[model samples]
Target: MPRFSIVVPVYQVQGYLRACLESVLDQSYGDFELIVVDDCSPDGSPAILDEFAARDERVVPVHLPANGGIGPARNHGVRLARGEYLLFLDSDDSYTPGTLRAIAERIDATGRPDVVLFDYARTHWYGAVKRNRDAEVFGAAGAEVFTVAERPELLDLFTVVWNKAYRLDFFREGGFAFPTGFYEDAVVVYQTLWTARTITLVDRVCVYYRQRRRGNALRTPSREHFEVFAQYERLFRFIEERPELARWRGFLYDHMADHYLFILRQRDRVPPSSRPEFHRRAARDLRAHRPSGHRLGAHIPRTSFTLLSRAPYALYALHRVAAVKRAGLRRRHRVWRRRLRKVLLALHGRLVLRRALDPRLAVYSAFSHRGVLGDPAAIHRKAQEIAPHIRSVWVVGKDHVDALPPGVEHVLPGSRAYRRVTARATYLINNVNWANDLVKREGAVHIHTHQGTPLKSMGADLLKYPGARRGFSVPKMLRRADRWDYSLVANPHSELVWDRAYPCGFVSVRSGSPRNDCLVRPEPGRRESVRQRLGVPDDSTLILYAPTHRDHRQGGYAPTCDLERLVAGLPGDHVLAVRLHPSLARHHERGLGLRDLAERGLVLDVTDEPEVADLLLASDALITDYSSLMFDYAHLDRPVVLHTYDWDTYLAARGTYFDVTERPPGHVTRDEDELARLFASGAWCDEESTRLRSAFRARFGGYDDGRAAERVVRTLMLGEDMAAVPVVPAPGAPSDVLTRS
Candidate 1:
């Protein structure tokens, strides 16, 4: 008998099957029988499994006669296994290198436990990887073997069969089998955990839990997702049979409540047409399952739980809006309090101040929060480096206080400390405006390091796009813009745009965007270091698809381009890196299908990445649609393809200042077909594209000479005068003169 039986139930995962098999077959610990159960897969997966089985004797292919679900396939694979331990794997996901070896080593060290639960990295298509959510539970469980009673927090670990290995005899003795249907593994995994006399936890990430582009039961929500209730019911019945496990009732109830609440929140998952029926089912399930006289723990919001438990339909229909409004009102109330505090600080400033502004005090806010890593962050770092005597205090939200970097003093947005710092700070730097009521005191300077190269119209232009500016007050915005002591710009076009957009009296600092300084002139090893951190092959033709957000959509800018088709059409040498606009990141769950494509190695989801510059440095080409990233990537002089599938709708909603076709930096592809044709023909970058890039650079890449941050620091932060700084043209910039309006 083999030491381990790795059971991978394959369905329609032909594209990813090879990678999954290779990951298992190439394991460092070779004493394992690979069970590939082809569950009557409609695709070419059966043929692929046969080929793999032929190639390696270890690969045992089980061709199911009918289309049974994953639960049945796994059960069949287990019964056919001849191994001491059993492990389940999904066809779309892969094991990390040496995972089996590591597990074996841990098992041997621990004297063989009944079950071993490990951690995994949730990988997205755009190369971004999220560590397991319940990593802390593993940390708390440690390496030592213990029962569920000893480490009850083990229940918190994600109930996924793929992330663990089970002792075959122990599992069989427990009479645990995967229940057929959605969330089939939930019942068995829970039972196995509680039934095991000795369970061990390993902190290592042994698997790449794929967030697939499509066809995942969890992602494709339906009434079937409600099957989780039945799975839990089976688990509860088993728990009630075991008299010793009675103490777990409250915890189990809380988990059930959380599961139902999760389903209720995913509004799209519950079809609008079937919502009434869905809510009724959810309400009935919660009522039937929830143990009477059980009080929810502090971790579970009492109000939301009570609402969900009693009237799931009403809670689902109305609670979100009411909750949002309540939260918004509370935020506004805090903002008003902060404004009042600033007013009081201003009054005290006039009465007791010897000097109007304190030169040593510099206040910074990046995206109007206490982040030490954006344009304002670059300015702060430069300021401290250039002038050590200057004390910098960052204004952050209450939640970000602990996340603030050491040695940097930070004040909560509305706290007295913030008011005091704002009142005295001579140099005020931010990517966006400060509080509305806080006027810029005389003698103090405000430097607006505008976040990115604006593609969509901003400031005054927002008034034209009603969808973009529903509640915005132009007069109030201009009033805030009126206080700008200086404004930073990447190019002369932006200088003109800012002047027209704000129409303020501030001097347009012909300095490049401080944020792009790292991209334009990266340090010697910065590019390699960042690429290493992102975990992409150095030789791969890195193509970045960084799209902007949409104004008309409530879920922000979702991808219109078919990512799976685009990935399939791309050259074998190429790897696409994806970065969604920040607004889109807020609503990424709506774009989970894109994640499925990521799982197939067709794209890398770098949307969660905080910095776009790192991805830019690693990429050789860019794919986008009306994003300011086009302007940033133009600085790299790389080939960019415009995937403007929703161009007409986008134009009518959030109009751009200039037509992209009129002076596009590279080729434009309206849809996936056009994109595929370009890649197939090897016309991604040509002479015409290069020429357009030169012209585009000449128009927008004037001031980004890698020294914008230094200039901002020397002049604004250190109180120096460098107004005559020359704005040199890029290396291949055209002689065509475009006047700086």
Candidate 2:
């Protein structure tokens, strides 16, 4: 028998069924059998399930005779389970990456508990993930394994069956089966906990319980919500049958009262016409199950419980209205306070702009104030080293300030201090343009450190492709560029491109790329350290698959290459590390199967990683499609493969400066089959690929020499002449090729 039997009850979840199945089938710990029960789904879920079963032998699909509810379908799956432990997952929900491995490790550590409970987060349809607020309940200290009585607070957790794993034998012995109807999980979850001989908590988020915007059975207006009362009745009956479990009577009573109030609050769940009867039934149950000398917790208001039991529906409605109004007033008061604070800050900033410039202050930002990263971060570090007199302050988004390195001072984009520093600072450096509203103060210098080489058409060059110029305004771009005192270019090609594209008055300096310095002169043991952190095996050939964002693609990222096919066809020693463009990172967690591949050790999702330079150092080769990262990777003399599956479409959508297809850095492949063949046949890093890379490097890799940051600091910040700055090393010089074990 397998270690785990994950039972998923499918209904009309055609949209989410595939993601859910992939989440299970792609687990890093593969010792699990997936039991997918199709409850006569009218939609396309059955076909999706059949497709998975045909491909993977581990997937076991069971078709029910008729359309049963979710509860009965789960019971059918459990009856067919043949694994040591039974776990349930809703067809619409999904397991987080490495969830099964984490649970298995926790089980072994806890000496095989009968039931292991783990935390779950709510993933909204609009791309927001929030962990359970009562996650602290799982943090009970002491023995690794214990009874429900040892940590009664676990009862406070959400009554969901999917968050916990039950030993198949223990569950079967207790005859724990979900009841048919709504709120069926409550009784089974509570009974399993109270009956289990041993219980343990994982204290980690194991599941992503998706909160759908529509088509949720419980969220719809229905009288089935009254089924909650029957579910609680079954729980109380089970407790009475086993007198030893009666200690939880008071807790159960309070839980029932809280759940009733919650249902009443959900206006969509309980209809307006049936609420009066629901309220009457709730009051009757409250009186009937009122445990003697049992007081509600301090966190819950006593008045609410009293009102639920004593008052009529009209009185309760009035109280709810008053409470809502008070809450709204408090929210409005907080909003006004925040607005007033912003107004005062703006006034103070305008006043500070009137003062003389601070020669010592330098403000830096990258990727339009997203974070302290890329060329701006490199220049900031270099300035502190050689130009100590200049105090550096990084401008970042408010949400990203915490990610800044320790001791690195930072200011939020719209804060008063950011405005003050931007106005009076002698040096303003950024890889991307600053806010359009920025005032170009005299005596202050603006240095536009271009982030990357222009493989694609940029700035005014994008005027030809209307799709590429979606939100771009050439007039506003030029106005921002007009404030620049200097434009740092990595090579002659970049200088020429910037001259035509930006058409600004700033002097273009061949200062090289500060970010690429790490590629040319990496710190000792840097490659090994980064690879170890990324969980790359010593024998593995790390292929960094960093793809560029497509302007024509709307909604979210659609992989240009068939990642699954490529991974499956490659050699076992070759590992694919995927780094999606920053613009697509937010959508990756939703539908992209990268997380599953990442958990399985076949792929690594390093999109959120701050430093792209570190990823470059960790990889043996790069596979890209029109990304400037290939230009930086060229300095390492590594093989670069261009996967131009959509070459014609991309050129039409977002025109490029040159034909990369004709002058690719290395071997080019238009499909995954050919891409896999190159890696399998060792052609990806062969002599022919290296020769192509050599010529490409000679053209674009001249400026980076491990001292670009130092040169930029000396010339721009320290007021040193270009002649005094370190000269670029001659062609065919010894380049640093990071060796892996």
> Which candidate ranks first by lDDT, i.e. highest?
2
Model 2: per-residue lDDT, tens digit, 340-412? 9878877786798789999999999999777878988889889988899999998988878788788988888
What local lDDT does model 2 show for residue 533? 98
What TM-score would every model get versus the actual structure? 0.61, 0.78
Report the lDDT of model 1 for residue 63. Answer: 93
Cα misplacement distance, residue 389 of candidate 1 (Å): 2.6
lDDT of each: 0.79, 0.85
TM-score of 2: 0.78
Q: Residue 311 of candidate 1: its Cα lDDT?
A: 65
Worst 10 residues of 2 by lDDT: 732-741
Model 1, residue 25: what's the lDDT? 93
Model 1, total clashes: 14
